[model samples]
Target: MYKRAQYQIITERLKESRHFLQVVLGPRQVGKTTVIKQVVNDLMF
Candidate 1:
């Protein structure tokens, strides 16, 4: 399985205890949803 740089970045930020908005910016079809799903899955499970 391959993971993008954004995956690690997002995952790290999500682990933070502080509260803030994390906005992901990128062009279309760049697996934004995929990365988000991966982050959620790893953190939740």
Candidate 2:
């Protein structure tokens, strides 16, 4: 599975709407997109 170290932190910030936008970036298959997608998915629940 895709993973990273900072997903939780970024996800938390997203919940708060503390920023206008959150950008996830990294090498392919490295979990940058995964983190944001996870955040979005989690928010729906």
Candidate 3:
């Protein structure tokens, strides 16, 4: 799981009014998908 600080940072960046794509990559089971889901959930469409 990502530390709260890091997750918030990414969330803040995504909140901006612009088209942005973030790519997360690492070894399998490193929580990349989990983090992406968290971000998507936190971000209101």
Tell me the deviation in Å of residue 42 in model 1: 0.6
lDDT of 2 by residue, 1-45 (tens): 544568678767776845657666678887676677776777788
Q: Highest lDDT, which number? A: 1
Query: With candidate 3 superimposed using the best TM-score fit, by how many Å does residue 41's alpha carbon deviate from the native?
Result: 0.8
The 0-to-1 C-alpha lDDT of every candidate, in the order given, reads: 0.87, 0.71, 0.72
Stretches of candidate 2 exceeding 4 Å from the true structure: 1-3
RMSD per model, one decimal: 0.9, 2.4, 2.9
* Candidate 2 weakest ten by summed lDDT: 17-26
The residue-by-residue lDDT of candidate 1 on 1-45, one tens digit each, is: 688889998888877999679998889999998998888888888
Better of 1 and 3 by lDDT: 1
Best model per TM-score: 1
| Model 3 residue pairs with clashes | none
Give one digit per residue, the lDDT tens place, for model 3 in 4-35: 44577688777788859866667997777777
